[model samples]
Target: MMGNRALLMNFMEKFLETVRFGNNDFAVIAGYGDVVI
Candidate 1:
């Protein structure tokens, strides 16, 4: 579980970096049903 979270963080960082947003304001939300992370 820890490893998976770490991997997700790494991927998100790379993605956000590529976007190059100055403010870097974003949200990852669960939509519909019962979402679990």
Candidate 2:
């Protein structure tokens, strides 16, 4: 469980980085955020 949580955290970090730096579509990112949540 801990390992999975840590991996999730790492993935979230990178996902946020992509949201911050990536010039992708707002709808797509928002969709991903909704899915993640």
* Residue-level lDDT tens digits of model 2 in 1-37: 9976886776677667667877457646754775566
Q: Which segments of candidate 2 are over 4 A away from where they belong? A: 25-37
Q: What is the alpha-carbon RMSD of candidate 1 to the true structure?
A: 6.0
For candidate 2, give the lDDT of residue 25.
73
Instruction: Give the TM-scores of the predictions, in the order they appear.
Output: 0.53, 0.56
Candidate 2 accuracy as lDDT: 0.66
In model 1, which runs have C-alpha deviations exceeding 4 angstroms?
21-37
Q: Please write out the lDDT profile of model 1 over residues 1-37, one tens digit for every residue.
A: 9987776776666556645754333322211111233
